[model samples]
Target: MASESDGQGRLPTGIPWSSPTVRVVLLSTVLAPLGVPLISPALPTIRDVLALTDAQASLLVDRVGRRRVLIPSLFAFSLLGAAVALGPPYWVVLAVRVVQGTAAAALFITTVTLIGDTFEGVRRNTVLGVNVAVLSAGAAVYPLVGGALAAVSWNAPFAVYLVGLPVAVLAYRVLPEPAGERERRSVSYLRNVVSALPAREAAALYGSAFLIELLLFGAALTAVPFLLDGTYDLPAVLIGAVVTLTEVASVVTSALNGGFSRRVSNHGIIAAGFGIVGGGLVAAWWAPTLGVLVAATAALGAGWGTVLPSLDAGVSEGVETRFRAGALSFRNSTTFLGRALGPWLFTTLVVGRGYRPLLLVAGGCALAFVPVVLLLGRRG
Candidate 1:
C-alpha cells in the first residue's frame, strides 16, 4: 500500500548510482529501438539469404503489434532472437519478427510508463529527454554493430537481440507493478484510460507522435536505404554510418531538449520540428550527391529529435499517474504502427510515381502537422 510518491522518493540520487529503477528504465529504452535499426544495416543481406523481395525484407521492420501481453512478449522476444540467430528458414524468421515487433512495443510503453510513475515536474521532463536520448544513442550504435557483424554473417545481427535477455532480467527485478486504486483487466483499464484522457490535448500529442514516426521511421529509415542502395550501391557498413549521422543529430537535439523547453513553447517547438523535417525531406529527395543526403538526414534528425521529447514531456505531464502506462502504451503503439505502415505505404507510392514524388508527399505530411500542433498550443 505504497503511494506513487513513496516510490519516487525512494529513487537514488548520486555517487555510484544504485537505483535499479533508473538502471532498468534506461536499459529498457535501449532495447526499444533495437528491433528496427539493429538489423537495418544488414537488411539487403537478409533479403538475399532468405530469397526475400524488398517488400518481404521491409516487413521484418514493420510488423510491430499488440500491447496487453507485454511481459510474455519480452520473453518471446528473447526466444525469437535466438531462433532468428540460429538462421531459421525465411517463413520462421518472419513469424519470429512479428512477435519481436510486439515485444518492442511492450518494452517501449513499459519504459515510458515507469518514468511517468517514478518522477514528476522538471525531473520527469529531464528523464524523458534522457530516455529519448538513450533511444537515439541506441539507434546510432546498433546499425554500426549490425553492419560489422553482417561482415561476418547476416545471423550475427540477430545475435545482438540477445541483449534483450539481460534487459528482461533487470526489468523483472526493478520495475514495480502499476498500483491503481483498483485492479482492472487490460481492456477495461485501456478503455478507462482513454475515457479519462483530455481529448483535445491527447489528440494533438498523440497525433504529433504518430506523424513524427510517419516521417522518421516511415520516410527516412524506410526510404533512405533503397535510395542509397539503388543509387549509390553503398555497402551496409557505410549505410550504417550515414544512418548513424542522422541518429547523432537526434542525440544532440534530445540531450539539449530540456533547455529548449525552457526557451520555447511546446507547440512552437513541435511546429518548427515539422517544418524542418519537411524541408529536410525535400532536400533529401532532390539531393544529387551523398554529401547532400547526409546534410538532409542531419536536418531530418534535428527536426524529429525536437518533436519526440516535446511530445513525451507534454503527454507525461498531462496524464494522470494511474492512466500513464495505458496512455503511453497507446502512444508507443502509434509509433510502431507508423513504422509498420511507412515502408508499405511509401513503397507502393514509389512504384507508381517514384522516390522524388514520394519524398514530396512525406515532407508535405510532416508540414501538415504544424498548424494542428499550433492550435493545440493555443488551446493550452
Candidate 2:
C-alpha cells in the first residue's frame, strides 16, 4: 500500500479552496446539517400555511430512519428537496421530509467515507477538521438563511434543499470509489473487518461520538432553546444569536484541531472536549442571565469542535483501508442516532424533574466518558 507521506506528499493537488476534492467534500458536509436546521425558522409559517399539527410540522427535518442506506438515500434526498419546495399536501410533505432524513444520512456517511478514502495521516486529520468546521459553519448559517427566506415565503427555505443537486454532481465527479469497495460490502468481509479492529478502543471512540452529539443536539441545541424561551423570555433574534455564537466557537476550535492533535494525544483531546462540554452544560444549568448562557454555549461548541475531528482521526487510524468506509458509516450512524435520540431522551428525562436536572444529566454524561477515554488512550 502507498504510504500517506510517500513522494506524493500529504496535500492533494490544487490550492485548498480551489481544489475539486476539497470543494466537493466540504460541500457534501453542508448537505446533512443543512437539512437539520434550515427548516427550523420556517416551522411556524409552515404550520400556519399548511394547516399542520405540531407533530406534522416537526417531521420536516426529523432525523428518524435515515441510517445505512447509502446511494439510494442521496437520490431520495435530492428528490425530496425538490418535492418539499412545491408545498404539497401536509401528508405528502411529511412523507417527503421523513425520506429526506434518510438522504441526509446517506450524504453524511458518504462524505466521511470519501474523506477517509481520499486522504491519509495528518492530511486526513486536517481535512476531517475542515469538514467538521464547515459542518458547524453550515449549522450556524442555516437558521439565519431560513429566517430570511421565511420572511419572504415559507416555501423559500425548502428551496435550500436544491443545493443538494449541485453537491451531488460535484461528489460524483470528484469522489473516487474506494479501492476494495466490492469486498467491503460482503457480510463475511465486514465481519472480518470488525473482528480485526481493536474492539474496546473502537467502542470508546464510537461511544464518545454518540455522547458528544447527544450533548450537542439534545442538550445544547434542543434544550437551550426552551431555556431561552421559557426562562429568559428572550426574543427569537436573541436566541438565534446565541446559537450562532456557539457555532462560531465550534468553527474556531475545529480550525485549530490539526494543531491541537499535534500537541496532545487523541485521548487527551477527547477528554478535554468532554470536560469543557460538561462544564459548559453545568454552567448553563446554573446561569442566571443571557451572558452566562452565551459563554456556556461557546464552551459547549468548543468541546464539540475538539471532539469530532479527534474521534474521526482516531477511528480512521484504527481501521484498515478496506473496512474504512464501513467503520466511518457506523460512526456516522451513531451520530445520526444521537441526534435523533437526544431531544426525545432529554425531553423525556426532563419531564417532572425540569431542565436544570436534565442539563446536569447531560453534563454528567459527558464527564463520565472522560475516564473511559483516558483509559483507552493509555491502552492505545
Candidate 3:
C-alpha cells in the first residue's frame, strides 16, 4: 500500500493542497458548487427552449429526495439507480438534478466526515473551513466559466463535470477511507443517526434556510445578472465575474473561519457568522456601489461557510459509527432542499414584485438569525 505521502515527501497533514485527502475535498467542493451556479444562469433559456412552464421546469430541477440519496449514500449501491432518471427529456433533466444535487451534498458532507476523522487539532477545522471556502470560490468562478460555455450552448456547465469527475476518481483512489468510529447498533442506520442529532432545532435550520436561500440563491443567479445587464448595460462576462466577487470574500472568510473555530467555541463562531451575514444584508439594502454590493455578498458567503462546518461537527458529535455517513448525508439532503428551492422562490418574487422587496426579504431572513444563535441546541 502507498504511504500517505506524495513524491515530494511531505507529512500528510502538513501539506494540504498536495495531500490526497485535501485533493478529494477540493474536487468535491468544486463539483458541488460548480453544478449549481454554472447551470443556473442558463435555466430560463432551457425552460423556454423546452417549452416548459415555470412550475414544471422548477419541479424537474428540485427533486428533494434525490438530494438526500446523493449526500448520504446510505444505501451504498443506489447511485447508479438515481443517475438513471436524471438523463434528459426536460422532466428527466429535472429528475437528474436530484442526482446532481445529492451528489454535490455527498461530496460536501462526506468531505466533512473525512476531514473530521482524518485530521485533528487546529488542522481539522482549518481543513474543513478551507474546503468550504474553496467550495464557495468554485461556485463563484464557475459562473463565468459556465456562462462563457453557455454563450455557445445552454448545457455548457454540465460539461465542466468532466474536469471534476476525473479528479473525484483520482481522489477516491488515493485518500484513505474514513474509518467509522461509533459503536454499531441494532436500530436502522437512518434512525440511529437521527437520534444523534437535535431534530427540532435542525428542522428550524431547515425552515430558515428554505426561506433565506430560496430568496438569496435564487435572486443572485436569476435576477442579479439581468438586473445589472438591463439596468447598467454591463457585459455578460463582467456580470459573470461580478457574481463571483462574493466568493472572493468567502475565500478570505473561510481561512478566517479555520482560525476562529479553533480559538472560539462552535456556538461562538456560528453566532458571529450570522451576525456578520445579517449585517452584510442590511448594508446591501443601502448598497449604492458595486464595491458595497460585493461586500455584502462576502459577508453572506463567509457566514454560510461558518454555519455548515459547525453544524456538521456539532450534530455529528454523538452519532454512532454505523450512522456517521448516514447522518451527514441527512444534513446534506436538507441543504440541497434549500438549494433547489432557493432560485425559484426568488424567481417567483421577481415575477410578483421586484428586486427591492427581494433584497429586503433576503437580508431580513439573514438578520432574523441574530437572535437564533442562543436557540440552536446549545451543544457547546
Instruction: Give the worst 10-residue stretch by lDDT in candidate 1.
Output: 10-19
Q: Write the per-residue lDDT of candidate 1 for residues 1-380, one digit (tens) a residue.
A: 11234365643222112556667778778877778778877889998988889998878876541123444556777778767889888888888888887777677776776666666554555566778889999988877787789889988888877777876776666556655624454778778878655787788888888788878876677788778888889996677577778888888887676667666866687788899899999898899898998788788888988888777767766777777766776787777677667777888878867677788788887778788888877754
Best candidate, TM-score-wise?
2
Relative to the true structure, candidate 3 reaches a TM of 0.72
lDDT of 2 at 100: 78
lDDT of 3 by residue, 1-380 (tens): 11355469642433266677677666666666654566666666666767878776555444342123223442221342234323357656665666665655566666677765565544556776787777777777766675676667655446555555456456546766544444454467557667765665555444444444554566555556656676568897677676676567667776665577657765566666667766766666677876776566566666676666555555445354456666666666666677677766667767767665676677776667756755664654
Model 3, residue 178: distance off in Å is 3.5
From the highest lDDT down, the ranking of the candidates is 2, 1, 3
Evaluated at residue 358, the lDDT of candidate 2 is 85
Off by over 4 Å in 1: 1-18, 43-59, 65-74, 87-91, 186-188, 222-240, 285-290, 350-354, 357-361
TM-score of 1: 0.82
lDDT of 2 by residue, 275-349 (tens): 999999999988888888889988999999988888888877888767777787778878878877888887888
Q: Evaluate candidate 2 by giving its C-alpha RMSD to the native, one decimal.
A: 3.3
Residue 30 lDDT in model 1? 82
lDDT by candidate, in order shown:
0.75, 0.77, 0.60
Listing every candidate in turn, what is its Cα RMSD in Å to the true structure after a full C-alpha superposition? 4.4, 3.3, 6.2
TM-score of each: 0.82, 0.89, 0.72
